[model samples]
Every structure is written in structure tokens, then in C-alpha cells.
Target chain A: MSASLKSLPSNPAFTLPQSNDVQGTTSASGPHIPAEFEQTLTLLTSHRSVLGYLLLSRSQPVSIIRHSGVVFEGEQGRKYAHAVGRIVETVQAGLEEVAGESTDTDEIRFMRIRTKRHEIMISPDERFLLAVLHDPTS
Target chain B: MSASLKSLPSNPAFTLPQSNDVQGTTSASGPHIPAEFEQTLTLLTSHRSVLGYLLLSRSQPVSIIRHSGVVFEGEQGRKYAHAVGRIVETVQAGLEEVAGESTDTDEIRFMRIRTKRHEIMISPDERFLLAVLHDPTS
Candidate 1:
């Protein structure tokens, strides 16, 4: 019951793993997922893992879950995921403008397109995507 | 001489040379006297000459100039340059928050910084440093 976990609202759609279960693998009981869906799920799972590492290193109580094809929360507290998502979106849009695209006025500006060399990773719960926006200029 | 030229407003003291004058070499009696100043002046001058070529090809007005011994402007117009400076500052702040040091925010955040390379020949008039802000992401 860390402060961050206490801050997030409980999401019944996804189960909250105990502190020890945070690193457990996903069950292989589900149907064979499409490659695209699997890729997206892997990205989300990776993102959750990274975030989990960050939070755990900070001794924060926040936990992330990727399920139901989307990343969600299991804590019974306040969630700052929306804020983090917005920040990611802002960075993506800035990258697009630098790329000479006119995405300043569009919400799709934040959506990172899949590329051969670069990609976004998701978790098993499908709660988040580890989106890596590369700056081709450098 | 125009009033702006006489007083030389320090904010954007540099000006773009006339199209015809963009090819001439710096005069022996140029205003910058010190060797370091002369070298910088030479660099700035050369930039102007290169910009002329780009302007001709792209049909776009691009210029660069030093201001107050600290600031430098790159291509993309007045508003865009200022916006870039602001974005640089913002990214610098964000990086500091994440990394705890003043890293090269320009390199990490925008593809425009890559265009800052590419040496150019200078013109006589110490007005502008013309270079392309090529979209690196493209």
C-alpha cells in the first residue's frame, strides 16, 4: 500500500498483482492473437514494466496492468496515467512538426506510426505502450 | 542609412544582405577587427552565401544571425526561430528533470539541429547566416 498505489483508483476489469507477482509472466490460455495485436500487446507490457521499474525504484506504490486490450489500473487511488499520456502526446506532436508535417492541430499528432527500425512496446495487460519517438535529426 | 541599420537594434542586429551582394567577400576594412571576431564574421558571411543558393532552389527566405554574443538564429523565419528557441528551453528543462544535467536538448528533441551542420561560404555583408533546416526526420 504505497502512496502512488493508494493514489490510483481501482479498476475491476484487471487484477492487481501482489508486490511479488509484479514480475510474473502472462498465462498462455488466451486464443492465438494476431501478429499486430501481439506486437501491440508486447509494447504495452514493456511500457508497464519500465514504468513499474521506475515507480519501484522510487519506492512508489503505483502499479500498472495491461488487460482487455488496454492498459488500466488496479489501485484504489488517483491516477496520473492521463497526465503522462498527454505529455507523451505533446512530445510526439512536436516531433511531427519538426518532421515537416502539419499535425499541430490534430489529436492524431501524438500517435506514433510503426516503423521498420523503431517501435512502441506494450505489456501483457495491454495497459500501456512503450512508445519511443526517435529524432531523426541527430 | 536606415535608422534600424544606424542604431543596430541588439535583439536582431543582423540583417539579410541584398541578393546581389550575397556573393561578395568581406572587405579588408570590415567592422569586425579582432581575429576571433573576424573568424566568426567570416563564418557568418559564408553562411549568407550558402543561404542564397538554398533560397534560390527552395524559393524560401531563410537566414541566420548572431545576437548579443549569446544567441544564434537558424533558418525557418523569425516566428519559427523564436519558437524553436522556446522549445529548446522547454526540452532542456524536461531533460534536466529527467537526467539532472543540461544535455544537448537540441540534438535529442528536434531533427532541425542536424541541419545546423553543412559548412557554407560567407558573403561580405555581416548580416545573415543562411543555411537549410532540413527535416532530419524525413
Candidate 2:
């Protein structure tokens, strides 16, 4: 597989020296992620199959909140971010169309795209979107 | 869930009176689908959770090869088909962009997008693309 084994924190814009302790702490990234979420991130990266994950703010401009894994770094990371946002938007629109018109409760909950090499799992909340890339065969 | 329970054959263009056989038979659908695939379809529809499936040919004008389930019927079915094709194309392009350039071996094998109500499983081959919609909670 082309994906790297080690998980790394790769934020494109902010280069602030961060704290290693995740207990009850927030991400240094743009959004004020909850302490529970930060703890969840700690738990997610510990798994063997999880290659990396990207957390994004779904507000205007769509910024990255936090990311893990080498595949979620630099230019490749940006592409993944863009694709995750676009796919969620597209699928939400498509679902509305399928139902004949837009409805308030028709919000998307989760999505998983499995490629030949990796699986991209996404979860969307009111303010945040999380995309996790994992190798199922691992 | 809004999805209907019964599985029905829903093809928009050609609705020939079909043969209801599973043993060593080809589909009445176009593009010469193999007997093994038709048998597989039979096996798939037998499952309790699988609400429906759509099989499409990836030719110049993508056409529906075979479809099962009420969610895959009529105008709604058309919407699903169009969305499936578009999503596949978008994801493929996104993968290429992630890789920085196009490669021959970067073909998408499978994709699963789980919405609040349904789960869509897609498998792409050299000639056909199969999309199966199932209720995971069921």
C-alpha cells in the first residue's frame, strides 16, 4: 500500500507549538473542538487499521480542525479535504432530489467510501465533519 | 424506513417480459450479462436487509443493466442511477487528484456510502457497476 504506517499531525496553516496531552484540551486548529472529541481522536489513532483522519469545520471557507496520518499531509491532505466536503454536499443534494424536494430532517449522517487500497469513513455533525481513512485489510 | 420491502425489477428503457430462472441463464437486459452475475443477483435479493440493487454498464451512454427493489423503480430510480454514476466519477477524479497524477492501477474497486436511512454498496468491474442499497439497522 502507498499509505504510510505512522500517524502524524499535519496542519497546513497553523504552526503553533502544541500540547501533547489531549485530556480535556482543545485542538490548536481553527475550530474549538470539544475535549470529548479530542479524547476520541486519541482513541481513534490507537487502532491498527486507521491510517489517518481529518476533522473539518463546515462553516464558510471550510477549514481543517485537525488531521492525522501522512496521507493527510500537505497537498494530498488538501485534496482529501476538498473531496470530503464536495462529496457530502453532493450526496445531501442528491438525497433531497430523490425525495422529490428538500426537507429539513434529510440531513446526512455518515458516509464510507472503500477504494481498492483504503476506506474513507466520514461523520458529519452540526458544526464539524470528520473523515477517517483506514486500511480494512490490515 | 421509507424504502419498500418487496424487491421488484425496475428498468426504465426496456421492459421485456422477463424469464424468472436462476440456473444457467443470462439476463434479458442488454450487454450480455453472464449467468454467474444473474445468479449472484438472485442470491443478493434473497437477503433480508438488502433493499435493492442497480447494475449499470459503463459505456458511452451509461445504461441500466439490471435493477432490483422498489427504491430503484421509476423516477426515483432514475435519480439514484444518475447520482450513483456522478458520485463514482467524482470520487475517481478525487483519488487521481490526491495522487497528484493519474495512474493505470488507481481504479476504484468498491464504495459504501451510509446515509441515515440506507447503505449503498457499489462494486465496479471492467464492464459493469453494481450498486446495492441495504438497511444495516434491519
Candidate 3:
């Protein structure tokens, strides 16, 4: 994953809309994803199988930092975001319960969910949660 | 996955303890996993990286049909089972919401979650839910 991020350092054509103004701003309102991360999103969405991608702030009152494609537009985006939050929380809590400890070292890294029509790949971190939906068979 | 099931027909040495009594019973009380599934579980547990697996009956009361390894023993198994239910439900609901329809055609097929120490793979169906936990690095 880090290799992919480093691969595309300055893909101007792939620069995201939100990254334009909030390049380095880390306001308390929401997270400030690095330019490399945005490039990675762009690279991921460029795949023919990929339908869209959603990047969310993982802090309290999770917020959508950036979203791409039609599937994650309007109310549907909010619904998917909420689902992501719940799924992450459930898995993290379950892991902690199994370990019987809440150590910082133990945390979720990735999730891949395959449905009838789409495959959702999620990368979760301390500050951001990224989900990419794609057609696996394609 | 299907190939693995076909590989093992009856390995008495690896046959789970439950399979001995509930070989061909599918009572309304709980799910009746086929003999092949039990063999698959046996095959999976034989892997050095695998920590455990939980096979749950996805019915009204969601009972555990079979579980392997110490990681999934006792109350810990119950917690993981509950988490699986919630994760499946949340993802299924989110998919339906995105499609804007409650079509039976749209449903979750599989989920793989990765944490710091373990990688959990879940296969959910109408009658059964199976989860396998393993150490990815190993």
C-alpha cells in the first residue's frame, strides 16, 4: 500500500478536488489527508473494475473527507459511511475482547467484503478510513 | 474453496468431535452442517497459521454449531459470533441502501478483516456463517 502511494508523487491530473484547498491544513473540524493519499485514491479509482472510493475521518463524529463516483453521492454516501463506522467498531471491539486488552498496537488494518455485485476494500487507520468499491469479476 | 472440501472426504484423525454425534442430523433445533464442511474445518485447523474457526447457525437464535482452537473457546466465541452477525447485517444493509432496492439478488458473499495479529475470513450464507482467524505474517 505504501509502495502505491509513493509511486504517484505528482500526478497532477489525478489530484482530487478537496486536496486543492486543504493541501496541508489540519483543522480540528476534520482530518487533512496527505497529497500522497489522495493520489493513491486517484490511482485506485482509475482501475476499470473500481466503481468508487470513500475517505472518511475516523475521529469522533466521523466525517467524509473525500468521495468519488456516483455510488457514494448524496444520501447513499452517508449510509455507506455509517455502515463503515459500525463495521470497523464491531471488528475492533471484537479483537480487543478476544485479546482481553486495549493496547494501541492491536488495531484493524484492512477489510475486504465481497457481495453479489461489488467488492468493498477498506483500509482503516487511526485518523482515516478508506473504502473502495469495485467489480471483482471484472 | 470448493476444491478444498472435495480434497477431504473422511479423515477420522481430523474429524471434529461434534461430527461424531451430529453426522447427518439437521433438526429444527439447530443447523446441520454437512460432513464436507466438518472436513473443511479440519483441513483449515491443520494450518499452523490458523488460530481458530467458528461455524454458527444463522437462524433466529444464532447458535454455535462448531468451534475450534482456544482463541474461540467460551465467552470469547460468543462475542466474536455477535460481532459477525452485526458486521454482516451492517454490510448487507449498506449494499441495499446503495442499490436503492431490497432485491434478493444483492447480498454479501464473503468478508476478510485484517488486524494487527490476526486475519479473519468470514463466509455468510442464509443458513450458516463461518469465520476463520489466522496469523497473516505466519
Candidate 4:
């Protein structure tokens, strides 16, 4: 919580190599779910007890992994979830261009999205984008 | 709308140098609204015509900017905006630790936060965090 802008900034290119330090976890193929990650998600979900949360990659046609949170009302939450992914992707692409084309400017890292009924939290990586959905009211 | 996990992966390490390319921007103290940044926000606000938006420094106690966008509801909205900044700070801290401690297994990039009546969009940086609020139902 004491981090300053000088301390952390986002890179324009998404090119981090995934670490293979995960152990005792089985993976069928790509992107192993680290024990620490699952633990963090479990802690957050239980402590926050949010409406609904999801873990999706930032690539095109986002792939969602483990997700547990309240379903947005009207099942519209699903659409909103998908829409949010696309929107963030677009924004990232734009920011990348802006960072390189114009000049070293606003190096955007993560984005916080608030709608009428949802609070979408998005965190980025060179490769993946993590989004969490919660109804702040509940 | 077509971002896939394989297509987009997180980059390793949180190491991006901050840019000092801001020009012709005078700082009376408060928040130094860079000319280009201000222009970008203005364009986004004009095109989106979103509810009032704010740019608050991620530092403790929070430093707010004279921002554009649709104004938030009333006094309550103002308080919520402040609260949102703190909440995001906490979340980012937690996420940062997760990224470093857990290994590159899950390199989280961005997060989307949703509440009962409002939607908050957050963009992160080592230096600053950007947050946008809007009514999802509206």
C-alpha cells in the first residue's frame, strides 16, 4: 500500500515468461495454477465473500480458469464479464501504442472499472490479465 | 473480444522505468496534470461522456487530481471515490506480493472492481493508480 508511481510502472510489451516453480500441482498443458495463486484466490474469495470473481487470461478470446463469485444479476453478469475482458484488451493495445508512438508518457499498469452494479478489478501481466468481479453493495 | 490465454501472456518482473516526458505543464502544487495526459482524459471523457472521473496519486492518504468526466452523485459519491482509492491500493499490494512470491505461474496484469451501485475502473503504475467510476445500470 506504500508503493509510489516511481516504484512500479507497466511495460508496453507483454512478454514475460511464465515461471515453472509450481510444485505438487498437476497441469495438463499451459499455465499451471500456482499453489500460492489458488491460496490467494481462496483467501480473497472467503474474506471478501464477493458476489462473483473470475480469473481470465488477457489474450484474444480470453480463457477463464477457476472462477467463484456471485453471478451478476440477470445473468447479464456473464456478458458484462466478457465485455470487460475485451474492453481491457483494447485499452492495453491503445496504451501500448501511445507509450511507444507518442513518447514515454502514461505507462498504464492496471485498470479499475466501475459500472452501475459491478466493481470489476483488472490486473495485468506481460501475458495475462486478471479480473475480479464484486458487487460492492453486498 | 477475442483475447485468448495463449495469445496474451504476462511478462516477467515488475521493472519499468518511469518517463519524465511531461512538458508545458505547470504545477501549482496539488496534482500535476500533464498536458498530454489531460488531453487523453479529455478525449476519453468527451467520447465516453462518462460520469465524473478522478486521477488520484496512489500514495498514502491519496492525492486527488482536478479531473474531468461525469460528476459523481453527490457528497456520498465523493466519499466513495476516496474509499475506492484505498481499496485499490490494498488490492494492488496484495497482488504484487502474489506475483513475486508465488512465482511467474500466475502473472496477473490488471483487475476490474464492481460494487452494488457503482463500477470502478483502476489502472496501475509504480508511481500512480488511475481509477474511473460509473453507473453500470445507467
lDDT of 3 by residue, B1-138 (tens): 344432322223223343444446667876667776767787788877678888887764567888998978998888788777767777776677666765564788778786777777887755678888777666
**Candidate 3: residue B31 Cα off by (Å):** 2.7
Model 1 CA RMSD to the hidden true structure, in angstroms: 18.6
| Model 1 lDDT per residue over A13-119, tens place | 12222323344343566333234444533443343222221011101232332233222233211132332343343443433454355434311212212122221
Model 3 docking tier (incorrect/acceptable/medium/high): medium
Q: Is the docking of candidate 2 incorrect, acceptable, medium or high quality?
A: medium
Candidate 1 or 2, higher DockQ?
2
Tell me candidate 4's interface RMSD: 14.5
Question: Quick one: ranking by lDDT, best first?
Answer: 3, 2, 4, 1
**lDDT minimum window of 10 residues, candidate 1 chain B:** B106-115
Residue A93, model 1: lDDT of 42
Return the interface RMSD of the candidates, in order shown, one decimal each: 9.8, 1.5, 1.6, 14.5
Ranking by TM-score: 3, 2, 4, 1
Provide the clashing-pair count of each candidate structure: 27, 0, 0, 73
Clashes of 1: 27
Tens digits of per-residue lDDT, candidate 2, B20-134, equal 3323343464567666677668777887788888988776455787799998998778788887887777787777778775564355767667677877777776667788887
Count residue pairs with overlapping backbones in model 4. Answer: 73
**Best-matching candidate per lDDT:** 3
- Misplaced by over 4 Å in model 1 are A1-38, A41-130, A133-138, B1-76, B100-138
lDDT of 4 by residue, A1-138 (tens): 223211121211111223344353445776666665666566556533245556666557766655675453333444544655655645544334423455543333455544334445566544455556644445
